[model samples]
Target: MIEKVKGILAGLAFRLIALLTLGQISPILSACVIIERDGKILLIDRSDGLGYTIPGGIVHYSETVEQCVLREAREETGYDVLLTGFVGVYSSLKRDPRFRAVALAYQGQIVGGTEHGSGEGSTCWQAPGDVFGHMAFDCESMLKDYLSEHQRFS
Candidate 1:
């Protein structure tokens, strides 16, 4: 038994040493979601440089999920949003073209800001069906989950 424990500890130490030598791994993180209200969804065009995507952005190192969501919404849409509930979490290795990102999705309601465009794309309210049809990523699953939650609660 002592020999087996020693072997396990040695194996763990070797793995730790190898991992430390491999250098730091960059973490890709983001917070976003399909903002829905009444029967429409919010969509935006990227202001940075790319195809149209849902309104959201990367999660800064020192920011909480709530803070990141609020900041991202305000930066991209020029409006402050009140997130009501969590929709889901998406962690696809290839979700972003440049890096892997784990996204925290939320169900939000707009409390302020006139409907306007900002960021890389124009901001507009689209029909729920149309929004799904034109989504930039695999957000339909998230949207579906949101709808399911609504039905379950309602």
Candidate 2:
């Protein structure tokens, strides 16, 4: 149909623009959370020159979101996590440094491993709103949405 063709073209055009501007199509699959316990959330400080951010990273090829979160948690926080569900998907050009990324933010709970910062930075626990003090980017907007849509958070 003509409408279908137009939709396909529109999607193609968007992809082409993103690839051209960001250098490459960085298919990043990341996740984060507004982990709250006793009215506090967990956060991290990424000294990778990218600044502090909530704990997460790229999802490996063939890995599911739950698997990615568990792996990333271990790599960054020295812990394994059990994913409850997705907070939401965040794919924005201005949020990250390079390519536009599709981050599958999930709600997870820590299960095991010692609390030691790994990879590119340090980790910490803070109030959900207070996280902005050390946040690397504007992911707080997404986090805020997750908080507001608690019913649909999963």
Candidate 3:
């Protein structure tokens, strides 16, 4: 399928770039969108079975972080979203097993499109409190940070 080929090519390209940089390249930049509706958050059950996490991925070379989050949300969750505001930035050496990454998290709202799962796995809305224990990656921490800030405003 085209998606599989794209994934392969992307992995190759990423590895090639990492090699070219002699590993001196800065951490890869990524963006994630926090989509909440009715007090439930949108989450993806990653295909690799790494558990649930927010919809996001690496930022493409031609796109801004905002554009990347929007695109990722649409691609992975089948939902078109509008970025409302930034939540925070997260970076840690051990955050991602593949490599160091710096992710910009933004709050968003669904504006169009329908919710569905892609090859990434199933998509669902879950209570914010229920998601932390089931999360993968640094999602638990990210959500905590976002929720704490959100509470202050609410």
Output the number of the TM-score-best candidate.
3
| lDDT tens per residue, model 1, 6-121 | 43565466456657868354445678756777787776754443435667877888998789888888877777899888877776655554444577788788889866675356
Q: Model 1: runs farther than 4 Å from truth?
A: 1-26, 47-52, 150-154
lDDT of each: 0.67, 0.65, 0.82
Estimate, for each residue in 41-135, the C-alpha lDDT of model 3 and write its tens digit. 99997766678889998999999988899999999999999999888878877776655678888888999998888887789989988877889
Query: Cα miss at 39, model 1 (Å)?
Result: 0.1
* Residue 42, candidate 3: alpha-carbon lDDT: 92
Number of the predicted model whose lDDT against the real structure is largest: 3
Off by over 4 Å in 2: 1-26, 150-154
Worst 10 residues of 2 by lDDT: 1-10
- In model 1, the worst 10-residue window by lDDT is 1-10
TM values, all candidates: 0.72, 0.72, 0.83
Worst 10 contiguous positions by lDDT, candidate 3: 145-154
Runs of candidate 3 exceeding 4 Å displacement: 1-22, 150-154
Tens digits of lDDT, candidate 2, 1-154: 4423543565576578866878555455566655555766666676554545667776778897777777778887887777776667666656654444567677777777788886557777776667665566556765676677652322
